[model samples]
Target: MKFSRRASANWKGTGADGSGSISTQTGALDKAPYSTKARFEDGKGTNPEELVGAAHAGCFTMKLSFVIAEMGFTPGNIDTKAKVTFEDGKITNIHLDLSATVDGMSEEDFQKAAKDAKENCPISVLLNTDITMDAKLV
Candidate 1:
């Protein structure tokens, strides 16, 4: 079986003081606030890179939970944060921070599972840039 997902974006203007629209093949459309200030700030609106980070974070967490379960451990909570850095109009680095609340898992085992998740997750495999992961078991 083969599957693919697609999204499209229409951007205008220069690096600063421009605007754009991002829409997926599913017909979900949103606006993008173009500018260093807007992107660095609260994002007066949605932006593409932010959404990519969010998607990667969520997918990573889900993958973490699944892997933990496979190892006979159930997670009480899994929190993940993804940081995407853009350089030269491309993604340069992605940092993943994850924390897990789970029983029956020692620090060593938990860290191993988290690292496996980071290394094996679909998003991590798909990204061409380097991905750094930091995980804590609490």
Candidate 2:
């Protein structure tokens, strides 16, 4: 199977005052707002790091679901937060915080599945920064 996605950005004027809108192929983000202030300072819009965090969190959750099912367990629910750190114009770290509920699963097994998902998920493999996870089964 193969898949491709696209997103575009359009901006005008200088970096400090310039503003842009980002659009994605899936229409999930249609002209989402972004600006220099949004990236470097406090602004009323979204930034690249925020979007990346969202993507990572979503991807990790899906991967965990698949992993749990593969282990003969049905997941009740999984909550994940991916914190992306951007410093000095570079991405430093991605920390994944995950909590899950699954029936008839041991804490040790759940942690193993979570670790596997964090290491082998497509986005995790694609990222070049440090990745860490804090996973718990509840």
Best by lDDT: 2
For every model in order, what is the number of clashing pairs?
0, 0
Give the number of the best model, judged by TM-score: 2
Off by over 4 Å in 2: none
lDDT for each residue of candidate 1 in 63-124, tens digit (9 for 90 to 100): 99999999998899999999999888899988998888999899998988988888888888
After best superposition, candidate 1 residue 114: deviation in angstroms?
0.9
Worst 10 residues of 1 by lDDT: 29-38
lDDT of 2 by residue, 1-138 (tens): 998989998898898899998889999999999998998889878888889899999998999999999999999999999889998889999999998899999998998999999999888988999999899899
Candidate 1's TM-score: 0.80
lDDT score, candidate 1? 0.82
Error of 1 at 132 (Å): 1.3
